[model samples]
Target: MLKIQEIRELIKLIDKSSINEFKYENDGSKIVLKKNAGTAVSYQTEEVPVQPVVNQAPPAIESAPAAEPVKASPEVQQESKAAEEDSSLHKVVSPMVGTFYAASSPDDGPFVKPGDQVSKDSIVCIIEAMKLFNEIESEVNGEIVKVLVENGQLVEYGQPLFLVKAE
Candidate 1:
């Protein structure tokens, strides 16, 4: 929210200057001061425009300055890493409709995890079609982002197996 004095100051500036518009931004909040060649000064934000109390004249109103782009933080990077370490890194998709399997046998461990680095042709998992198990290969070299299908789940041809961020 903009303070009343701040609004008045902006109006004063607009009144004195020849510039038709002026704006300032801080974090999410913004204040825009606008005036025509000869008109009343008005302030506006992303929400409602703040109309100045008309002691005498109507003020000019214009939109606030454009918002700056948000920057990614370290926490976002760590989260992305954790997601890559998770099973979502498998970039290879299913070539045919079948059931997804982690290993060749029931007693064996999973073929891959989130953090496991994979390359093109890496056997990430298995897709069983018509009682035949086919080894699924990784098509991209990258860290995993997410696993779309679970083990033993029925998978369709061309289904996404994992999301991978390229190295």
Candidate 2:
């Protein structure tokens, strides 16, 4: 446990420093404090996970096409040929780091699904980031060919979220 004096000294150090967030844990007590420039500070405490750590390297993946049977459906084959000829049906990527919400709320239906048509500025879904819910708009006028992420999955910036076939 930290003494009151120690906590006060930590606050003082934070005020004098330029760091935005600080977290510390000791003797079963944990504290998280954040200071935003020109914004009020926030404080919270939560228990930390105690688990054994393992450092294992991930396997590398090949980028080229697989050397197996090149079987494709008639529609998929035509689409692939057309895709090679065109450049519009590429990808729509996420613009921020957040949980990908396919619907506005859990009980609500998905905003867009495979085979759904969309227009420019159409709200496809919501992405919750930093405690803020942001509506994601479709930048391309197209039909959704595929949804790349499951609902509520963590997504990174620039990650491909959908395959949009230009209309």
Top-TM-score structure, candidate number:
2
Query: lDDT (CA) for every model shown?
Result: 0.70, 0.74
Q: Across residues 1-167, which tens digit of lDDT does each residue of candidate 1 receive?
A: 66789778778877887877777776556665656544544445557655653444554688888444233467755664565465533446789987889788899987777777778778889998888989988888886556656678777788667777767
Scanning candidate 1 in windows of ten residues, the lowest lDDT window is 37-46
lDDT of 2 by residue, 1-167 (tens): 77778877888888789886677876666666566543232233445453322332334676986334234468865664554444667577889988889998899999999899999999998888889999999998989987777787777899767778987
Q: How many clashes show up per model?
A: 12, 0
Q: What is the lDDT of candidate 2?
A: 0.74
Give residue 153's lDDT in candidate 1 (0 to 100): 77
Which prediction has the highest lDDT against the true structure? 2
Query: What is the clash tally of candidate 2?
Result: 0
